[model samples]
Target chain A: MAMKIGEGKFKENVNKNMEDTFMRGAVAGAQERLRTRRLDAAEELGNWEEWRSHGEEIRKHVLDNLDYYLHELAENLQKRGGHVFFAETADEATGYIREVVNANGGKKILKAKSMVTEEISLNQVLEQEGCKVIETDLGEYILQLDEHDPPSHIVAPALHKNKEQIRDVFSDKLDYKMTSKPEELALHARETLRQEFLTADIGITGCNFAIAESGSVGLVTNEGNAGLVSDLPKTQIAVMGMERIVPTFEEFEVLVGLLTRSAVGQKLTSYITALTGPREEGDADGPEEFHLVIVDNGRSKILGTEFQSVLQCIRCAACINVCPVYRHIGGHSYNSIYPGPIGAVLTPLLGGYDDFKDLPYASTLCAACTDACPVKIPLHELLHKHRQVIVEREGRAPISEKLAMKAFGLGAASNPMYAAGSKMAAAMMKPFTKNDRISSGPGPLKAWTEIREFPAPNKERFRDWFKQHEKGGGEQ
Target chain B: MKVTLFITCIVDMFQADVGKATVEVLERLGCDIKFPMGQVCCGQPAYNSGYVEESKDAMKKMITTFENAEIIVTPSGSCATMFKEYQRIFHNDPVWRPRAERLAVKTYELTEFIVHVLGVENIGAKLNGVATYHPSCHMTRLLGVKDAPMTLLQNVEGLRFEPLPNAHNCCGFGGTFSVKMGNISEQMVDEKVDSAEQTGADFLIGADGGCLMNIGGRIERRGKPIRVMHIAEVLNSR
Candidate 1:
């Protein structure tokens, strides 16, 4: 699957998602649950701020010394007989992965859910070569079963789908008679996936953080599917964004703690596995031949830019959970595999403004996402930067908005213009005023009136009132 | 304390009563109030919309307008936050950056000024009603003025305070957003109005005029009995 999931315009996707009451309810419920859990987890830590700061430091340090760490990680991994390919583009990344799959004569590949893999459209590449790639993560597996349904959320791929929906998908595809209880559905999925896990020709997992010092790739998951995906197959490939590297195991531990708490509000997920290279002689588990594909895909462009901090993200959806926009519109509205505030920022950088220009403006600049970010990425600020780029640099903004904003700047900056504008507001709004509120209006007011009543411009401006009140000696 | 009023554009043109209450509240606390007529909008409507270069004109106007005031105060937390933002906005400008810094340090949201600067929790205000507060996102999250609103509200005589469900969420009046993405803003504001209704409160109080207008406008359209109020107006109650 591609990074951009749903077809049509961003607004079209939003309107469609907004109309889906089932999806909206599911998203809101999950947001509340995850939000509370994250808060509780952070509260349990008693020093979440410190932990967050540490996480930010580690990620920032890694990003700053990325080249050194990448070289070191690659050297150490190759020393342990692992193949490391650094792909500066998505096409190159997918090309190398396809070569590995073809070389191994891979079919029926077992995969741990990975946003990077979704980003690079690896599954589509493999499928074109006639490979049946199975999504092992429960959320991803549910989506995969539903005829390649694009994931709505990053961590919880099927977050927009309720249990009943999942059960329906399973019943239609797997033809199983089972209750909608999560346990029952999961058990059935587990039973179905167990054989595929053991017999898959190749195992592919997403790396949470590539440990440079130990040359190990860490996988953090609640499902423990990563362990099985990397262990059961003779050939294994781990894909990671180039920026997802840590200096050593020490920084890795710190980040994993922050990631789990922020994403699921757990102290640590059910399984946190860090594997170093291929299995040695007499090793019980792990692949004999391992390949690491480090995908750049437009990340380096942000390194020295104002958005350098965005690369510090640990893929924790804490920002997504707290976002009011994401709460109302739901994840599918974002259209990218990386949804919510992060998507609004990253998608434009990777996918370009042609498709994602409106993504940045989708936010209210509430800073909830910024506050929720464990690694201290200024998500809201980055979003604002996108807007500036669209208007100032890109010149993609509508001419009407450009004119209106230009007028706003002039009226606001000059005292005479502001006074005339303020003085004329009430008079200009008179025709629309009804009982001190503009129920219907013009221009921007037309949009405002469509949703909510617009307040009639006060006949007496506050400055005029203040002048009179001061003449009355500021009497109450 | 001498206080200069930066009554935000929404208050100046639309919600004058909010500005009035803010002045009265500060005056009763024995602080001298200054109203600089040159003050206009905080450039947020433009700035937040991505017209950063255009927004600087207004930001500079604001900086110059309140340049001489000992301390600046506004009823809107979001506007106050914007005032604070000017420093960072002009961080690289050698000419305006220092001036922006001076203005930011002295600026305060009304509730913040009353509680933090005035050092008074309550001003002997009394309001008998069931009410809840909607903390505007920029106020609580950006400005970090979370406690001041509650501290004063909790001390108000005869006011029954029930927390609004999902109080941390935005009221969906993101200046331009309510207009640009009206559909999404509609959903958000409707949910906010529903949450306030869930509280069964007579009044829904907020610290920002823009948020009040959004929530209040929806409450009006839906014809809910709940009265939308500004925290300044609520605190100004006798």
Candidate 2:
């Protein structure tokens, strides 16, 4: 129910996720489909690289002057009669929202898919206050209906579930008989959510990007649920990570272009609603009261550090879509609402090493996520930075690994040590070698050998063979 | 052209045949190759494992080892990519930074050197078999050597090449990752092998030794008929 999903340990989570053949199939299928679609969309949008660069530049600029833009945004929002709250922590953000809901005597709350709210565990907090919180986004609605299944992915909250799984969840919870076809399942969810939209006293949505110039919060969605969440409710609360800000509409337009194309391979989502302040007089349909809660929750700590670039993320999930590790392990393995590459990097920073130490090491340093990032966050490098921190500063790495690395460093750095080690490797490994392979190895080799045969160390090392050939003592 | 061979530690200690094939192929291409005896590991194994300070010593040793070469070449794309990484690793040290940068600029993977430097795609090599190439992640994605191997492979006479499905994915041979995250690594390598088998190729070819070792080891264990060959071995074949 919190940012850290299940109670299982990191390894246990991964092992469990690995065994779920159904989830694995669903994740693999989605990855292949999403990866190809992203490529096609990028190809369609000529000069995608330039757009990415522009997106990167805009984010970097905003981050560099985040204080300035935050002030400007707050001022403009206040000028247009919108209450703004700067929450430095998750507790503060959730507490502020609860106060507002209680003040309004709100019993029912309608919500769009908002990761920040999930990160803060707002729904649970509200429910404990005897308030009924209903998720209106199709994915979030399914998850909410199924006794609060934590989101597996950022964009597709219910990505781990197949249509069949959704149908079962809907049938069991809502007493609706429906086929596993997507249209039927979606219609069933839509019909149920429409009633909540009309009746809810308050609505909560996550901001995709807040435009500083006009003090408008932008929401990009395929289901058009965010528009209803904002327009229908009397008091609408938009929660955002403080870093999700653009300096102006120009930058907002550039980022939105990158976000849609990168997230779901769409040129544009079905709806991109930008609501500035509560509403002007004579407005057709809009929230009478609007509140923007900018939640830091340890983000500001990353501002001046080596990982500041991570703040440039547009919540696109392009990195998640392309990550090979995520493809096999699935999103639940990450054990966070924000899964995949971004989650691996951000979770430890927000949640600390006690719970999330293994997330950084979860990668193979393949840089696939880095390549896929719309804003070019250099994700793999950041992951490595986390490793460096864990090893050097935190001292969280295992003692055995530390000892092995020390020996490795000494041997690799010294020419004599390396030569001697190389020469002695074959003899040392001879006991385990059989038919040019070690089917079962010892020490570190055990892990590798468990899955595949390890090559027997060559008795005649390449250097020796090359030396013999140079003297004409061996055949070429 | 004179090329100093940085036969990576993997080739020197484990897969010596890959190194031999690389030398023969380069020599046949009219290259005067020099073996840098002082060369050691590229420091990647330590660097990637988060032992940055410990790895720098090895990196500095490598930079000095190939200091005088006109061009340094290696059989392993991942190692060559590590050579390029030396610059970033030493960015803080003023003296070693420039040296690392110089070392990176002249270093090339064997196939990259052959196709890009020598301007030769086909060396008239012949091998009769259906083969699929696994573009190792570090080599193709980091070093940006995507086209060179394919350029040469397309020209190998009598060799029918089938593209490996989901070729862009990592083979789970992320050095220490194979050992540390063995469970996840198994799944990844298994998927890679499945894709390679799906191509119905008789041989699996790869530019990096680490990838070949992982995938090849799995194929051997599974008792699959597919043979794994280094790109160097394939190019050297007659």
* Residue B69 error, candidate 1, Å: 0.9
Candidate 2 lDDT over A1-476, as tens digits, reads 67899778878888989999998898888998999989899999999889889889999999999999999999999999999999999999999999999999999999888898988999899999999999888888889988888888899988899888888998899998979999988888888888888898998999999999888899998989999999999998999999999988888888888898888889899999998889789999888889999999999999999999999999999999999899889898888887899999999988888989999989999999999999999999999999999999999889999999999899998989999999999999989999889999778888989999999999999999999876778558
Lowest lDDT sum, 10 consecutive residues, model 1 chain B, at B162-171
What is the Å distance of residue A98 in model 2 from its true position? 1.1
- Model 2 chain A worst lDDT run, 10 consecutive residues: A467-476
* Model 2 chain B poorest 10 in a row by lDDT: B27-36
lDDT by residue for model 2 (B92-204), tens = 89999999999999999999999889999888999999999999889888998999998999899999989899999999888899999999999999999999999999999
Candidate lDDT (C-alpha), each: 0.91, 0.92
When candidate 2 is compared with the true two-chain complex, its DockQ is: 0.86
Native-to-model Cα distance after best TM-score fit, residue A428 in candidate 1, in Å: 1.1
Tell how far residue B75 is off in model 1, in angstroms: 0.6
Which ranges of candidate 2 are over 4 A from the true structure? none
